[model samples]
Target: MTRAEGRPLRADAQRNRDKILSAAVRVFAEDGLSAHLERIAKEAGVGSGTLYRNFPTREVLIEAAYRNELAKLCDAAPQLLESMPPKQALRAWMGHFIDYATAKLGMAEALRALVESGVDPYVRSKEMMLDALASLLEAGAQAGTIRADISATDMFAALTGIALASGKPEQREQAERLLDLTLDGLRTSPR
Candidate 1:
């Protein structure tokens, strides 16, 4: 439903695209590259034509799905902060990050294959993640609930370490404990 150059997508078209991307993420994560586009269309409640129109190729769909998930995770930062104290917001956001990480692991093999085919599926991932971390940290620091010296990069590394170390269901408890420890370390001393 896009028009000539510089025109915005029609609302229905945008909705269809969003649906397709969301469905693609779940399908790809669950089934990897073996997931069929027709199945994705069914999951999205859209026609195959709509899915094809939005994403012409498998690589394009995979890349778009991964980017869409990243955007959803990163976009949660401000919404969480708005509804809760910054410390709580950061903690909540961490949980969302964990979920994102889990889905990401499922999609990793497919994304790697996409990269092997010369399509980088994560062009803006690092920057987007860093920005999300920075926002959460900044909110917490401004509220005097978190230390100011922590770098977003360092925090992201810590989260990634925790996720990788305890990503398994059997190690979920330990992972939670580690995440709590990391969160505890972010607190500033009461002045």
Candidate 2:
């Protein structure tokens, strides 16, 4: 991956950056905005200097972690389609979406602080999500496994509703049930 300055990171540097972002997501989710950078560095198996070099500030780290999660979620659509049928791919992707939503919820406080700093961590998030959803819906429609009339915006809204209602760790079963119900409703022939 390229650095913010458009320079390509070395292999080791990219690995370190990935580790830092993964650790930052987990640490910030668990400890909120005031989590220690040293702890994140330790969790990432990287030095403090490495973390600081990759992300100079707490806001930068938080935004990077969230954007990393979002990128993974949106990128999963094509990967899932390659691995399974369109309907099944979409179903699997719903689970990923719920996981993403849960992580996003966990980082809400950190994200709020980032937003209050006059930076929008969510820039392009909605469009990116809709594009992913639209691709999945189009694939399913072509396969005749999903209804043709559903809009990506409507599907996104419904998924957001499901996430908000049952996206917690303890509520995963409920979330799965809700997702299945929603998916069933999207079928060409409702089950």
Clashing pairs in 1: none
- TM-scores of all models? 0.88, 0.96
Residue 137 CA displacement from its true place in model 1, Å: 0.8
Instruction: Write down the TM-score for model 2.
Output: 0.96
In candidate 2, the residue pairs with backbone N, CA or C atoms under 3 Å apart (3 or more residues apart, or in different chains) clash, namely none
**Deviation of model 1 at 155, angstroms:** 0.5
Model 2 regions more than 4 Å off: none
Poorest lDDT segment (10 consecutive residues) of candidate 1: 1-10
Give one digit per residue, the lDDT tens place, for model 2 in 81-182: 999999999999999999999999989999999899999999999999999999999999999999999999999999999999998889999999999999
Steric collisions counted per model: 0, 0
Candidate 2's displacement at residue 81, Å, is: 1.3
Residue-wise lDDT of candidate 1 within 150-171, one digit each (tens)?
9999999999998888875567
